[model samples]
Target: MDIISIIAPMILVFFGYTIGSTRIITGGNEALVERLGKYNRKLEPGLNFIVPLVEKIAIEKTTREQILDIAPQPAITKDNISVEVDAVIYWRVFDWVKAYYEVEDVEDAIGNLVITTLRSAIGRQELDETYSSRSEINKTLLEELDKATDDWGVKVLRVEVQEIKLPDSIMESLEKERAAESEKQAAIFKAEGEKQASISRAEGTVQAIEMIAQALKGQSNSKEVLKYLVAQRFVDANQKLGESNNTKIIFMNPKDVSEGVGELLEEDTHISDERIGNGSN
Candidate 1:
């Protein structure tokens, strides 16, 4: 009975030692083993062995990539505009030893660093620039974070500026300014169209006058024809004026227009006769 008790106790001790020393680190995870409270070695995924009671698993962390979402924080722009800014960072641990020992809290340190860098970057740019140059800000953040976190064994894969929110007053002002600008452009375009329409109408009138003069050049009764045309134009003008809602209709004498057309036609005939005489000579 004494021999059996001793052997059974030895077997129990062996089984306890075996169970205590064996560590099954799952895939995508790594562990740091410390010997006598000092970092001794890294335990990779799968079955790992360690000295029981002499060594300990100090920390176990996953090697997979992680996401850090920075909440919206108040920031002042270069132009002294207060705004809210937020971002997201994608990172991973490349060297576990440095990640564990070099920084007290790698995640916290990275987050704080990102906040400081983001503020600095925003402070260097105006509010308008911040909205337009989001890519530039993101690049600056990624570069700064990657450089700063190198010693911490953290690789910042990318940085994204999620949102930049402006105050309601500022947004309303910008909207008003944009609306005013659009109205000004619309007014300019309307004025340009009216001006072009006036030019086209004047050109059409001149062309009609030229065509009438050409048609009447060789006619023997050109003066009579001109008188009829002048009378017709006067009648058409009175008809158009009468069609208007606000126009005052003043009837003109046909005799007066006929007399004016006679005078103009006489002057034109005299000029043409003089030209013909000079050509014959």
Candidate 2:
């Protein structure tokens, strides 16, 4: 029994040592092995055997995509407008050794770097530009971050500007300015329309006058045409006076009316009575 007890302890110890030496790493993950507190080699995913007491696993890093959510940060624009901006970052570790050793905290480092880059980018643009040029700003930020984090064994896949908060006063003022501009444009358009209408009316009046003059010149005797035109004008005037309900009647002597009619008829005569009378005299 004493011999069996000693052999059982030895067997358990051997099994424990073997179990500790063997490591099963899953896919997309890498383990860094260190010998005597010094980096010895990188272990790929699978069953790997290491000297249990002499070799230690330094760090384990995953190669899968990682998402980092950045909190809202205060930024100043080129026009000195203060704003709060937030974003998200997509990244992955390319080299396990460098990722573990180059930076103390990878997540925090990336967060801070993003904040700084966003602030700097925002500072270079005005509030209007910042709102309009989000895509450009995001591309620049990704490129800068990728360059900065390359040494840390991280690859930035994408950077996105999620939200931007602006001051209420600026927004209100912009709206008012836009409204005023629209009103001014409308006024200018109205004035142009009036000017065009006036020009058209003047052109039409000139054309009408030219047409009337041509008609008069085409007549064989303008005197008959003038007599007919004067008669039409008198008829139109009489019709207008009759249509007015408030018109008042005026009394006239029969002799005066007869004399006026006789004068009108004599004035319309084609032959000159003055020449005939002079000949007689």
Candidate 3:
């Protein structure tokens, strides 16, 4: 080779070594260094250096929180109903060394583990419990995942169920049940209202009758007052019967009621005249 060609290769090698040896890790990130295919050291955020050919960056990833969405998967409940459940998991890497070395594709491993645990948890509960115990399910999932993924050097912050889908038949049955319950409640309320109203009317009628009896007993004959009230009630019954569609024609003697009331008035008038005569005497 010529002198110029030799000089060019040396300059390129020198620049390549300088560039490869220097490493820059930004905020919210971590790096792993491996020397000769073995674990060497970890690189933190900001400036870092590695021995060009002897050491290399094995894994570089963000240490901040990450979200993993588990797609809808079939899980059978205790009652044997199939459900489609989808969830989101919040996770963060605490120890980057074990995170990179312990598991291949740590996120995937964690996801699969979570799905397995989710299925187990759902299998233990009935379908009704699944709907009402969502918080409990999340707590169980977080606890299980945090324990299981400890070797993976990650902490599970939270697991939330995003969607839970029931079968069409189940939904229809629930709708019918709700509708029936509503109708039953309406019927009960109507019966209670009618009962209360009947009681109020009866109480009012009794009070009015008692007051009228008292007033008549103080001023005139109580028996005549009772007879008049009975006759008036009878006439009112006939009037209401005539207004009804059940057309039963009835004949009543108005003179009979008038004659009875007229006798009572004459007696009271005679008594008042006798008192006046006695007072004069």
lDDT of 3 by residue, 1-281 (tens): 69999999999998998888989998899999999999999899988889988999998999999999999989999999988998999999999899888888898898899889989989999998999999999999899999999988999999998878887898899899999999999989976876686578658756765566555644556656666775675577568657756346576774575456546656765787889899999
- Residue 280 lDDT in model 1? 100
Candidates' lDDT values, in order? 0.88, 0.81, 0.84
Name every residue pair that clashes in candidate 3: none
Number of clashing residue pairs in every model? Answer: 0, 0, 0
Worst 10 residues of 3 by lDDT: 211-220
Best by lDDT: 1
> How much is the lDDT of residue 37 in candidate 1?
93
Candidate 2: which stretches are off by over 4 Å?
A: 1-10, 34-41, 51-58, 126-143, 160-165, 208-281
RMSD to native for every prediction?
4.8, 10.4, 6.8
- In the range 1-281, model 1's lDDT, one tens digit per residue, is 69998899899999999999999999999999999999999999999999998999999999899999999989999999999999999999989999999989999999999999999999999988999999999999999999999989999999999999998999999999999999999989976876686578658755765567667876888768877776776677677657766445679797797677677667877898999999999
lDDT head-to-head 2 vs 3, winner? 3
Residues 132-193, model 2: lDDT tens digits: 99999999999999999999999999999999887788779889999999999998997687
Model 3 accuracy (lDDT, Cα) = 0.84
Question: On a 0 to 1 TM-score scale, where does candidate 2 land against the true structure?
Answer: 0.62
Model 2: residue 171 alpha-carbon error in angstroms:
1.8
